[model samples]
Target: MSLEWLQRVFGAKVLQFVMILFTYETEEECNTIKDDLKRNPDLKQLLEKCGGRYLTCNKMMNNQSEMRDLMKKIEHLFNENQQQCYTGEMPNTASIRKKKLESSEHQCGHTSEMESNAHLNLILLGKKRAGKSASGNTILGREVFMSKKSSKSVTRDAAVKSGTVNGFPVTVYDTPGFYDPKMGTEEIQKILDKVLLKCESGPCAFLLVIKADSFTEEEIKTVEKIEKLLGEERLNKTWILFTRGDELQEENITINEFINDTEALKKLIQKYDQQFHVLNNKIKGHSDQARLLLVKILQRSFGIK
Candidate 1:
């Protein structure tokens, strides 16, 4: 496939002339283009530069602070997509076909499939009152974690809760709040150090719980501290779980639109490959939401569907 074809997804505002090129490419050609983009460093950098120019120009055109902030969010999203495309990590026709083929084989009595028997171990990490414990309860479809409204940190130590969700044995580790005034720095470090060992042996997904209402300054600092501790490799396994979906619903805002509105959240999400999920802890009968979350975790983290 031509590079022109891949350019169309950026839209007329970004790449007007290449919009029609994708209609004529075959599946094999498309795969070839992805391969070229991955292997050709010069080509990848050129495309990235083009995207950066568009983002810069767009920002310059917007004078209002809110519009400029929105542009920054858009820039993060665009740069993320561009980076994935360059690395051939973004979902394309070839990857979709491969996943479908694997799905069919798994369905055809592939009992030895590793993902089927794999355990999902999730560690909830966030600041105080970010809904970490509540999210843990929602994931297990039960009130296993001590979730309550309070100015003080409800969970004083690391706790483990286990249950089967969406056919996978799920283990959730609910930890103490980061930057809790009652806890010292050394105590917090000891707690996190102990929990890190739990993820060493199994398929793990770190649920970085953040409230959907807003990304506060304390939340941003907490995220930075976590990233510093986990580093980039563990960060890749992390997913942003926005709690209190009910608030977003009450305001008639979709998660996508909400993320788009927050530049910091957008940057964080982009840094993590756009992996995120939303849960309404207030809502009863949230089993469906919990199951769907496990499904997503399986597909993305374990490459299982």
Candidate 2:
């Protein structure tokens, strides 16, 4: 897209957010390109050096600068659909929850058992070594999902574990890491697509896990990509869960203060209407963080608040 068209569509700042935040392709397509780039070292370097010979053949100025500019505009155009969600208009949480509850209530026949023992369907999303499985264990209040460090991936596919948290029957789907640009193998993609089946009654919410210690540029892009893939509807139901709360405690800073330090992180929290909570996955047993997460989900997903 031309810079002029971008300016007209979502203004300059949104354009910057998109350009710097996500790639110029759908989630699957972008992953495939990244895979190809990694598999071919020479081709990858060529892409890095020239962007593409044909695209830069006509350029007389610095090739790298032109390529960077071209990429930003391309990414901005690809992420144009998400622009509507953050065009300076905030989402009404009550209305969103009411719409979700209408369907959830329908599936349960509005019965007392369903009402008193409602299940919260949560899908955890994040990158490698981002503590997704550990977070699941923390929420389940047990070792339902093995939590350990490794050079490779911990959760290879999606796994569902159901348990009660704060009086709510909670079903959590722990998804494999997809933060690596080339991580979307067919099997991983298939599992991610299937993870939402837990909410056949209509999925209520998604939990985006980010480590409080380091909210890097790549992590920011992962958030944007997942947000785009989930689309605006599910994103409204999405909550940001920062894992490794101990880091925040060590730094002796509140999440609000940390968010204020970074523009991209701030924008993400604002996009979700400040629906974020922290989890110290390293904690051994039941956690107050898990309880608070359940409460927030009830309010955000079922209008319980």
Best by lDDT: 1
* Candidate 1: stretches off by over 4 Å: 1-117
> How well is each residue in 144-194 modelled by candidate 2, as lDDT tens digits?
986689767787778889987754567889888876544665656677677
The most accurate candidate by TM-score is 1
Worst lDDT window (10 residues) for model 1? 16-25
lDDT scores of the candidates, listed in order: 0.73, 0.70
Give the distance in Å from residue 175's predicted Cα in candidate 2 to where it truly belongs. Answer: 0.4
lDDT of 2: 0.70
Candidate 1 lDDT for residue 207: 89
The estimated TM-scores of all candidates read: 0.62, 0.61
CA shift of 8, model 1, Å: 44
True-vs-predicted CA distance for residue 15, candidate 2, Å: 56
TM-score of 2: 0.61
Clashes of each: 1, 0
Score residue 99 of candidate 2 by CA lDDT: 59
